[model samples]
Target: MGEQKVKTLAGDELKAIKEAGSGKKKSRKTTSGQIYISSSYNNTIITITDDKGNVLTWGSSGMVGFRGSKKSTPFAAQRTMEEMLKAMKGIGITEVDIFIKGIGTGRESAVRALNGSGIKVRMIQDRTPIPHGGVRKKKPRRV
Candidate 1:
């Protein structure tokens, strides 16, 4: 029988594989990165993506602290940010462009907490759009 051949990953390939698995993306033209902060009714998610839209260090508020109500607090959001910043510190991420969504209390707390956590927030852009007008519907007929 002929010998079988196997493929191997080069250093670049290995790094790419690692980055892919890490869920974080790196930028090309710019060294600065961005972080996406979102809060839903029950949880908050922090997606740390570079300028290229690759998520670097991400965390969820629902996954930490005690189970139940504790997870829904603003503190949970802070903890989630802590985890994200800790991960970013490993990758030498010092500054981030923040994009915040939702009206949860956690929104402000999370950003404020980041100040003491060693991560510099260069900008905070609220992506929430306000509806300019009411929805269209047929007028009700009188009986």
Candidate 2:
């Protein structure tokens, strides 16, 4: 084998690719959307999306530089929500239906933060999954 062949696109294809990749994403006018709060034992993540599930923005305690157990604390969650709300506001999100999906210590606090942000809360739904006694119990420890 000597030289390898290089692949190239036509001028129109190249121009289309450049136009598609060069511009920043277009922001739409969204007045109401959905908020997903995922609070876990180690962290809290808040994601805001349009009604159609297109994520507008998100923030986490870890994103705010919280480390270790601090990332799971209510204060951390509140702060994370505050950061997320700032982004949401710029997107014109003034009303939301919250769907929380965890039982971490920060769960409620994060909602409170959003409520205090003056955005109308259309609904709060807990999407946490509950066990229906499916897993077998472990053997009891003996002395």
Candidate 3:
């Protein structure tokens, strides 16, 4: 009979997996990276990526133990950033270009947290979607 497939991961693949304390163990060294902050009405998610946008690690308010309405608060976002900051430093990221989205309360706080963490912010760009007139309304219901 043919050999069954093995579930084992190679050393490199194993290292790619997120660690409990530091998020990820970067295989290559990098000093500058991109920070993507997705602040929705319900929660804030921060993702760290390489210069080419390859995701290195991410953290969310929910993962930081925020619940219900607390997840949407700026404080939760700050906490989320604290978690991500540890991973960022472990991966040797010193500078970042931040891209923010959504109108949630965590939007500005997430950015400020990164800025105040001693990491140089190279740029802050708002990538929020602004509908250009948006889609047409549906026709009125027939009588």
User: Stretches of candidate 1 above 4 Å error?
Assistant: 1-31, 136-143
CA lDDT of 49 in candidate 2? 90
Best by lDDT: 2
Best-first order by lDDT: 2, 3, 1
Off by over 4 Å in 2: 1-17, 140-143
Clashing pairs in 3: none
Instruction: Give the alpha carbon lDDT tens digit for every residue of 1-143 in model 1.
Output: 99999999899999998877996555333346898888766778889888788766678876655366666678889888888877777777878899998776678778877888866779999986568887998899999
TM-score for all predictions?
0.69, 0.84, 0.76
Query: What C-alpha lDDT do the candidate models reach, one value each?
Result: 0.78, 0.92, 0.91
* Count of clashing pairs, candidate 2: 0
Candidate 2: tens digits of C-alpha lDDT, residues 54-135: 9888889999989998999999999999999889878998889999998899999999988888999999999999989788
Task: Please write out the lDDT profile of model 3 over residues 65-131, one tens digit for every residue.
Answer: 9889999999999999989999998889999999999999999888877878999988999999999
- Give the TM-score (vs. native) of candidate 3: 0.76
lDDT of 3: 0.91
Task: Point out the higher-scoring one by lDDT: 1 or 3.
Answer: 3
Local error of candidate 3 at 59, Å? 0.7
The alpha-carbon root-mean-square deviation between model 2 and the true structure, to one decimal in Å, is 3.0
lDDT score, candidate 2: 0.92
For candidate 2, the 10 contiguous residues with the lowest summed lDDT are 20-29
